[model samples]
Target: MKKAAIFDMDGTLVANSPVHIRAFEIFCARYGVTDWREKLANGFGMGNDDIMRLVMPEEVIREKGLAALADEKEAIYREIYAPDIRPVEGLKELLERLRAAGIPCAVGSSGCKANVDFVLDSCAIRPYFDAAISGDMVSRCKPDPEIYLTAAAALGVSPADCVIFEDARAGFEAARRAGAGRIVALTTTLPREELEREPQADRIIDSFADIDDIGALLA
Candidate 1:
C-alpha cells in the first residue's frame, strides 16, 4: 500500500514556462527562425529533441546535430532561468506536507536531465524528491505512459497508488494511460477552464495552496 506523488517539473512545480519559451525564442533567433513564439507555444510539453525536430529544419539539425542544438537551447534556458528558479506558489509547502506524511515523491518531467537537475537544484527542492525521471530516460514523451510508469517504479510504488500532478494536457493523458490513482491538474500553465475540459484530470487547482487536504485528495 505504498503511495507516491509524481510531479511535472516545468509548469507544474516551477513557474518557468516563460523562461523556457524565451530560451526557445533566443535559440530560434540565433538560427534565423522567425515565428518561434507560436512554435514554442504549440510545442510545449514535448521533449527537447521533439521540439527541436519541430522547429529546426532538417539541414539545421544535421549541421548542429540534434544533441548539440538541444544542449545549447537547454544551456540558454538554464542561464535564463537560474536566477528565477523558485517553485510554483505553494509547491514547497505541498512537498513538505507529502514528505511529512511519508508519501514518497518523484519528479517526472519532459525536460532533459540537465534541465531537471538545474530546476530542482536551483529551487533547492532536490532533497525532497525520492526519484527523478526526465525525458532522456524515456523514448516516448508525454501522452505516453512511459515516464509516469518509470517514475512509479523508481519510487517503489504501484501506478495504481500514485497521484500525478501535471499542468499540461499531454501529461494528464499520460497519467491516465499509466492508470495512476489520481491526476491533479495545475493551472499554472493552462487556465482552469482549459484544464477542466480534460477528462483525465481528477482535480484541478490553481496552486498547491488550494489543495487544503492533500492526504484526503490522495486517498
Candidate 2:
C-alpha cells in the first residue's frame, strides 16, 4: 500500500502566475498581438502551445513555431520569477511530512521541463521530488491525465495510490481522470467557489497549511 504525492508547479507550488502573466504580456507585445489580454483571460491552466495558438495567428505560429515561442515566453518568465521564487505557505512542511511518512513525491506540471526544473531548483525543493512530468514530456496536457499518470509511473506508484495537488480547473480534471486517491485543489489561481462548483477535486484548500486532515483527504 505505498502511496505518493503529486504536485503541480506554477500556482500550486508557488504563486508565480503574475510573473507568468507578465511574461505572456511581454511576449505578445513583441509579436504585435494587441488582443493578448483577452486571449489570456482563460489561459492560466493551458500549456504554452495552446496559449500561442490562442493569441498568435496561424501564420505566426507557423513562422515562429510552438517550441521556440514557448521557450522565449518561458525564458522571460524565468528571468522575471527567479528573484521572487519561493514556495507557497506550508509547502516545505507538507513535503517533509510526506517524506517522513515514506511517501514518494513527484511533479506533474503543464509547464515546460525547464520551467519545472527552474522552480524546483530555485525553490530548493528538487530533492523532495523523485520525478517530474512536464508539458514537453507529454503529448496531451492537463484535463487529459497524461502528465499525472506519467509522473505517477515515474515515481513507481499507481495513480490510484497518489494524491494529486492542483490549482487550476484543468489540473483538477486531470487528477480526476487519473483516478488519483485524492485530488486536492489549491485556491492559488482559481477561488474555492469556482473549484467547489466543479466535480473534479475531493477537497479544496487555500494553501498547504490548511491540510489538517491529511489522512481524510488521502483516503
Candidate 3:
C-alpha cells in the first residue's frame, strides 16, 4: 500500500490560528461587520470563501465590494502574522520520522498557496514536505475533501492509504470524505468533547508533542 500522511497547515502545523482570528476581527471591523469574533468561533475550521459567505450576505457583499475586502483582510493577516510564523512543536521530528520511513507527506490546507508558502518558508520547514495542495487549488476546500484528495494525488498516494493530521472539525470531515485510512486529530481549536464527536478521527492529541509514539499510531 502507498503510505503517506497529509497535514493541515494553520493550527495543525503552525502557531497562527489565534493570529488569524485576531486579524479576522480587525478585518471585519473595517467593514462595520460586528460579531466577527463569534462568527470566527462558529466557523472554526471553515475556508475563506465559506467565512465570507457567512459574514456577509450575498446582496450586501455585492454592494460593498466584499471580494476586495477579503483580499485586504488576507493582506493584513499575512503582513501581521507571516513574519512570526513557525512550526508546532515536534513537527520537525514527525517529518523526519516520516522521511526516514520513506513515507511521503503532503500539506493539505484550507489556506491559499501563498499563505502556505510564506509560513513554511518562514519556518524553514518547506524542505520537509513532499508536496502541498491548498484550498485555492481545488474546486472546494475542507469539509469537501477536494484539497486532501489533491494532496494525495500530488504525492502519488492512494487516499485509502493516507494518514491525515488535522486540527479542526472541517479537516477531520474532509479527511474522512477523502477516504483517509487513518486520521490524527489535534485538539488545537476544538475542545475534547467536540473532537471526540468527530467519528472520522482515529486518534486525538493535544499537539504533536503530546503524541507518545506517532509512528506506532500511524501503523
Candidate 4:
C-alpha cells in the first residue's frame, strides 16, 4: 500500500473548535435560538449543513433556508477567527517531514469550501496538501466515508494506505468507515478519557508534537 496522510481541518488542523462554538453562539443569538447548546447536544464534529438543521428550528430553516444560514454563520466564524489563525503545534514540521519523505497528503474537512480555504490560506499551509475535500463538495459529510474516500481518490492513494488524522468522535468513525490504515485522533477538542472511552482512534494524542515517529504510526 502507498503511504499517505489525510487531515481533518476544524479541530485537527487548528484548535479552532472554541471559535466555531462561539460563532454558533453568535449566530444562534442573532436568530433568537437561545437553546443552541442543547440543540447541538449531539456532537460538534458534524458539517455545517447538519449543524444548522440540528440547531435551527423548522420554521427558521423554512424562512432562511439551510444554505443561507450555513453561509452566514461561517462568514461570522471566519471574521472572528481570521485575526488569530495559525496552525496547531508541530503542524509545519510534520508537513515538511512528510514532504521530505515523499508521502502525499490531503485535507478531508467537514467544513465548507470557504472555511477550508480560509484556514488553509490564512495559515499559509495550502501548498502542503495535494488535494482537499470540503463539506460543500460532498452530499454526506462526516460519520460517512465520502469526504475521506474522495480525498484518497484525489491523491490516487488507497484508504488502507492513508493515516487519517482527526479530533472528534464522528471524524474517527468516518475515518474508520473509510478503512484508513490508522486513525490518530488529537485530544485538542476532547479529553483523552473521553476519546479513549470509545475505540475509534488507533491512538490519541494531545498535539502533533506528541508524535515522535509518524512513520511508525502509519505502519
Candidate 5:
C-alpha cells in the first residue's frame, strides 16, 4: 500500500518559530508582560492558548483571554515574517518526489487555522497537502495524537501506514502515540542530538534533503 507522509507546519516546513517568538514578545509587551523570551524558549511547539496560560498567571489568563491576543500576535507575525517565508531547503524537492511516487501527504500542526493558512499560503505549499489539520480543529493539541490521527483518517490510510515528520519533542511523542508507520524527527527547532533523545523517531534528520532516498523512510 502507498504510505502517507504527515508533516508539521511551523519550524519543520516554514521556519516560522522565530517569527512566532517575536510576535509573542511584541504582544505581551502591550499587556506589560516582559518575560516572553523565556516563555517562547520552552514553548515553541505548544498551542497559543497553552502558551498564554503558561506565561500569564491564572487570573491574568482568565482576564486577558487568548482569542484577543492571538489575533494581534498573528498579525504581527505575518507582517514581520512575510518577506522571508519559504519552505525549508529540500522540502520542495521532497514534496515533488512524494507527488511523483503517489505518496499521500498531510500537515498536522498545533497552529491555529489562521496561522496555518498564512504559513501555507505564504510558502506556496498549500496545494501539496492533502489535508491540513490545525490545533483549532481538535480538542487537544500535540502530545494527544488526535491531529495526526485526523490526518491519517483524512488520507484514507491506516495510522500504521503513515509516517510523520516532526520537529518538536511533543510532536514526536504525538506521532508515536498516534501509531504511525514511522516517525522521522527533523531537527530544525531543536538540535539533532536533542531530538534524538525522544526515543520515538525511526530516524533523525536535519532536513528532508539529508535523506538519501526520502521514499525509503516509508519502507
Candidate 6:
C-alpha cells in the first residue's frame, strides 16, 4: 500500500506570497501595467503563465514573449525572496521524521522549475523529496489535479494512497479531485478559519509541528 506525501512549494512550504506580490508590482511598474496587485491576488495559486495572461496585455506578451516575461518576473521574485528563504515552522523536522518513517515525499508546485529549485535548494530540503513536479512538468495546473496526479505517479504511489499538503483553496480542491487519500490544509497562506471551510481538507494544521504522528496520517 505505497503511501506518499505531496507538498506545494510556495505558500505551503515557504512563506513567499508577499514577496511574489511585490515582484508582480515591480514587473507591472516596469511594463507600464496597472492594478497588478489585484491581478496577483485574483490569480493566486495559479502558474506564472496563467497569471501573466490575466494581467499582461497581448501586445506586451507578444513583445517580451510569454516565457521571457515569466522568467523576468520570477527572477525578481527570487531576488527579493532569496534572503528570506526558510522552511515553514517545523518543516525540516517534519521532513526528517517522514523520511525516517520511510514515507516517500514529493513536491508538486505551480511554480516554475527555477523558483521551485530555488526554494528547495535555499531551504535545504531538496534532499528529503524523492520527486518534484513543477508547473513546467504539467500541462494543467492546480484545480485540475494534473500536478498532484503527476506527483503521485512519479512517486510510484496511487492517487488514493497519497496525502497532499496544501495552503490554498485551489490546491485543496486539486487534491480532492485527484482522489488523494487525505488533504491536509496548511495555514501558512490562509487563516485557519478560512481553511476550515474547505470541504476537501480532511485535516487543517497550522504547521507540521501540529501533526504529532506522520505514520498515523498516512495510515
Best by lDDT: 4
How many residue pairs clash per model?
Answer: 0, 0, 0, 0, 0, 0
Cα lDDT tens digits, model 5, 1-219, are: 438888988888976677787777787778888866776676666777877776765676677678776667788888898888888888988888888889889999998998889888888888888999999899988878899999999999988998888888778878888998888877778887787677888888887789777547768
TM-score of each: 0.96, 0.95, 0.92, 0.97, 0.94, 0.95
Which parts of model 3 are misplaced by more than 4 Å? 57-60, 64-66
What is candidate 1's lDDT per residue for 1-219, written digit by digit as tens? 438899988898887788888888898889999866766667677788888888888899999998999999999999987776888888898889999999999999989999888888888999999999999999998878999999999998888999999988778888899999999998888888888888989989888889898658778
Ranking by TM-score: 4, 1, 6, 2, 5, 3
All models, RMSD in angstroms: 1.3, 1.4, 1.8, 1.1, 1.5, 1.4
| lDDT by residue for model 3 (1-219), tens | 448888899788886778888888788777777867776765656677787877765775787674566677778998998667778888888888778888888999988777888878888888889898877778887889989989999988789989889988788888888999889888777787888988888888887777667567667
Which pairs clash in the backbone of model 5?
Answer: none
Cα lDDT, all candidates: 0.87, 0.86, 0.81, 0.89, 0.82, 0.87
Error of 1 at 110 (Å): 1.2
lDDT of 2 by residue, 10-126 (tens): 899998878887998898889888888877767676688887788788898889898898899889999988887899999999998888878889999989989988999899999
Q: Judging by lDDT, tell me the better candidate of 4 and 5.
A: 4
Per-residue error at 131 for model 1, in Å? 0.4
**lDDT (Cα) of model 5:** 0.82
* True-vs-predicted CA distance for residue 46, candidate 1, Å: 1.5
Per residue, candidate 4 scores C-alpha lDDT tens digits across 1-219 of 449999999888999988988988999999889888877756677888898888999999999999999999999999999889899998988998889888999999989999889989999999999998998899999989999999999999899999999998789889999999889889888888998886878888888888888668667
Colliding pairs, model 1: none
Tens-place lDDT digits, model 6, residues 22-59: 89889899988986776677677788788899899999
Regarding lDDT, does 1 or 4 come out ahead?
4
Which portions of model 6 miss their true places by more than 4 Å? none
